[model samples]
Target chain A: MDEAAIDVRGLSKSFGGRTVVNSIDIRVPKGRIFGFLGPNGSGKTTTIRMLCGLLTPDGGEGTCLGMDFRTQAEKIKEKVGYMTQKFSFWEDLTIRENLEFVANVFCMNRVSERVEKALKGLGLESRADQLAGALSGGWKQRLALAACILHEPEILLLDEPTAGVDPKARREFWDELYRLSEAGLTVLVSTHYMDEAERCHEIVYIAYGDLMAKGSVEEVIAKTKLKTFRVGGKNAAKVREALEGNPAVATTALFGEDLHVSGTDGEALKRLIAPQASENGLSLDEVPTSLEDAFIYYMNRAKEN
Target chain B: MFSRQRIKGLIKKEFIQLKRDRPTLVMIVMIPVVQLLLFGYAVNTDPKYLPASVILRDDTFLTRSIVSALERSEYFRIAGAVFSDNAGDARLRSGKDMFVITFPDGFTADVVRGKAPSVLIEADASDPTSVSGALGALQGIAESVIAKELKGPLADLAAVRPPFSFTVQKKYNPEGFTRYNIVPGLIGMVLIFTGVMMTAMALTRERERGTMENLLSMPARPFEIMVGKICPFIFIGFFQSGVILFLARFLFGIPVLGSGGVLAAALLLFITCNLLLGYLISTAAKNQTQALQMSIFVLLPSLMLTGFMFPFYGMPEWAQYLGSCIPLTYFLRIVRAVMLKGAGFADVAPNFWSLTAFVAIITLITMKAYKKTLD
Candidate 1:
């Protein structure tokens, strides 16, 4: 087993008498791409911010890169690259200038060489002189990532790195993350996209200041113990709508033309859906619980608690 | 406590941004020029070339000499001669002339006989400061003229001081040009605006644009960030001081009597203090608009209580204490003393040290208060 890159216990934070992050423990192994999944306002960004020393956690005790996260933040900052959820590079600065600035901030030598390499790596050499504010969303994300890796940081804490990007751009961005991870860099990325979450080596789901689930994608799904059944018929929508009001059914989500109904109690869910299934004349096939179904199950379960 | 490389990067970035910001660049150059011209030609507290009329009932050589001296004194321009007291009084009442110089009958004879008759000079004393300097000049002119006329056998009478003949030797600004006071003080005002407003906006703009979080997450320390951000404006402050001093010298005839090195050193300290204050303000403000609003809290007290607009000593005791806390009050004193009074380093050492202490204290506070994290 690899050593943990970020191992913190009882991490907590609050703002203005409202708890944003409860006492949550997180541990990501070195050289792994750890996914942080949560709905909006679920403190995913806050947790990422705290890890990179952009914000001070209200309560926590642990080490990042073998140093105390609280007392040795400055040391941690030297080795950590934090890409904010927002495009936080200077908008008025050109792409090359922005990269150069980051290099200088890290006090790296051969600034022009490094900036040029970053520009080329981003495939933005032709547009190096363009202002960052003028770039499209995907290009801006690339610039931000390029800036983050300029210093060759050991750990990358990305907060929703591809939030507003198109799917193709997002795919390319995840590929870059995987490449960085393969190079032995620890990556802790927070995202809302199911495909993105499924690509992670492991994922943690947090909701309402609580860590609901944490494991590999399949492990998280199995932990939910949700028995999901897929049904496709003329009355699929009617069955989905009818199962939503049933207490036995945990969650119902429509994927394309098919409906996925999930529940923690397999027998009770089957018993409740069989009658509706017969009435709608739709055949039900047991299916593996997907990451989205597991997440929705966790979200609903968290809301109940 | 600071890294040279990070500071250099911050300074370079700031310079580029400052260059691109056209309005701020224009303000940087235009503030000193516009303020100097506005205050130089327009705002004069000491009114000169005031109109006056002579009521010469006992016209003699002494009286004529005194009247001519008054005209040459440039404090008053003789509008005309009046035969009756009513006409002179009416002229003063109507504001046609600022003063009515009345020579009582046998005034010269009484002086010659050593009877000590008084020359009645009635002045319109409304708006006292406007007339105070001219009235004071009148005393000097009248005494000298009488002494010149009372000669030979009358030398003894001249030797004896006249009834109102206590001389006030106005030092430094003998003419009491208001620009002499104002022009030097403008150096402090210009620096306060540029140093405080520009630097106050520096960090706030970064935070507002969401760049501050990324910047903080870098290896650069707050000290490096603060110093780097403020270093570029130090040159702007020097350029502004140069502009104001140049205009003060050639345009308004104000002297740069102190040592250039001493003035420069003192100015450097004052400018650093103001910039540090602005940096401190930036730490507290959240956006550009908030920075601007916060800067006014500093600039207003600087303008009003720092002896810029009103006399520093004239403020109430508590207000004076409040004024003393402001760095500009010391800077205004230092700049004025250095420019007008030819004060050397030793002469202005106290004020210079006050600004030094201000720099030290504010630097400590700002660095301590500067947030390394968003918390």
Candidate 2:
């Protein structure tokens, strides 16, 4: 019910005769944490760039932060904070110097004060004098995040902000995002981790330049209409092999010691797996469909198309 | 045996990569050929056919014969004859002629009456090397003129030291000190070499480190970024120019004869022009190595053809035309005319205007080449 922060329709882009981003539409409501989930080379970074005015979409008409994305790109750029997929800050400069440079570029008053505030906010005060290149991966990501939000823009477009971060650091980063969102900042983040996707208020899955699905975590799962039955036993491998190519089953994947059999049709999937469960002495139990199950289903279905 | 198959495989891989890198391949093949042509034909130290002016006060047979004999020597080409010594001095100060031959009134009568007539030969000696060869030929030319002209009854004049004396005055640089010209030229060369190369690498370094994308995504304008990047180098340029000028004054004893204000203004214009050229090169180049190669390409031609190593007029017409287009050539003339000849603002206006035009054109081209949006 909140007003849309980023509302674009029919966005498309191509490079060297290949369509990298097809006619995809995206909408993120104000103050919501929106996650973009996709495989590698799925045009996630390209789409983020286009949304922030770093790139011009070949075909699209939209508005970001209440400004026309096409004609008023300069105005739009002023209100959006874009964090690149790479750690793009100056590596040779110290953390304080980098922050000061960005502050100066934005033409902010009280530069040293603002730099000190940003340093303290990110808990980077101790390493303020350290060169950015010498920091660990987590610290670099934190520094990039700190730099993007220095101007207090209305929206943040982060391209895989936590790609190579460790689990603990990733959790801390997500917490920071939650705090920012709580303070009414609209966040559009692209990520690959399923747990991270679950944390987002809404998620969109894209594969091979096409938008496969978009909704909240439970909504996306329910939209798939996927029925998953877990099989556990010493004969899990045999059960997996028997139910893999069945016409009734869409996917059979291993999850640790259990085999997940999923299909769109609930009854057919149950009926096909019952015979295998009985013959192989396997324990079969219907379980809730997970985001990973839906994602794998979408990925396989897209490959087929 | 030393694994012949592996060696062959490595060689094949290397060749394929080399072929794919078109810039490197072109540099490898073209650099040597270009260097050979530039050094072999375009550069000549023994400079001939230097332009000279004649001040003919008394038009006698002996004066005509002396002028004809000087022309036949092939070292001096008489551009035109001026009426007054002031007019001829202006021509020399403006670098129109390398030397001026002045035959005062009654010179031919004095020589025939056994009174030695003094012929005033004033030469521009800023670039001592360029005029040294031509000056050496003058003595031989004077002796030959007397030997050839004193025929029939006047042959005795040939035995008394040619019955004439040459008061050769080396104008601007009386001692013909080589450093007087070379030190000023070195200032231009140093500015070009460092200012252009450092600026050429500035943008490429950002792009290589992935920081350019971040900078572009910010609210900063293209002009703002360009100015920010170039201002530091401008300071460096002025600093370098000051250091060289100080050294030239104290260590080498090269005097700054003209107005310091004029020289400073010219230095500022020249430095800005080179910085703009470097920015233009950065826009065309894709990476740091390509930028460096581009800088070298510009540096080499300016060094060889900018009248720094060879006489500007001594070169062939085509080479001189090429030198006229280089910014360093104009800057060299401006610096020498100001520091050595004590030239004023009005004297070096042409070079000043040419450098200003060059700066404007290069700034426009560089602005056009720099794109705001990523493709």
Error of 2 at B180 (Å): 2.7
**lDDT score for residue A75 of model 1:** 91
Per-residue lDDT over B1-375 for candidate 2, one digit per residue giving the tens place of the 0 to 100 score: 889999999999999999998888878887898788778888878777789999999899889988887789877899989998888988887787889999999998899888889888899999888888887887888888887787887888767665887788899988878888899999999999998998899888888999988998988887788888888898999999999999999999888898899999998999988998898888788899999988988888888898887778667778888888899999998899989999888878888999999988988898898867777
TM-score, chain B, model 2, is 0.93
lDDT of 2 at B226: 80
Clash tally, candidates in order: 0, 0
**lDDT (Cα, tens digit) per residue for candidate 2, span A1-305:** 77999999999999998988999999999999999998889899999989877888999888887788888888887788999999999999999999999988888899999999999998989989999999999999999999999988899999999989999999999999999999999999998889999999999999878999999999988989999999988778888877767787877888877898889999988888888888888899999988888888888887787
Give the lDDT of residue B33 in candidate 2: 85
Q: Give the top-scoring candidate (TM-score).
A: 2
Model 2 / residue B259 / CA error / Å: 2.7
Q: Write the per-residue lDDT of candidate 1 for residues A1-305, one digit (tens) a residue.
A: 77999999989999999999999999999999999999899999889888888788999899899999988999999899999999999999999889988899899999999898888898999999999999999999999998898899999999999988999999999899999999999999998899999999999999989999899999999898889998877768888877767787888988777888988898988888888888888888899999898888788778888
Q: What C-alpha lDDT values do all the predictions have? A: 0.83, 0.89
How does each model score on TM-score?
Answer: 0.78, 0.94
Clashing residue pairs found in predicted model 2: none
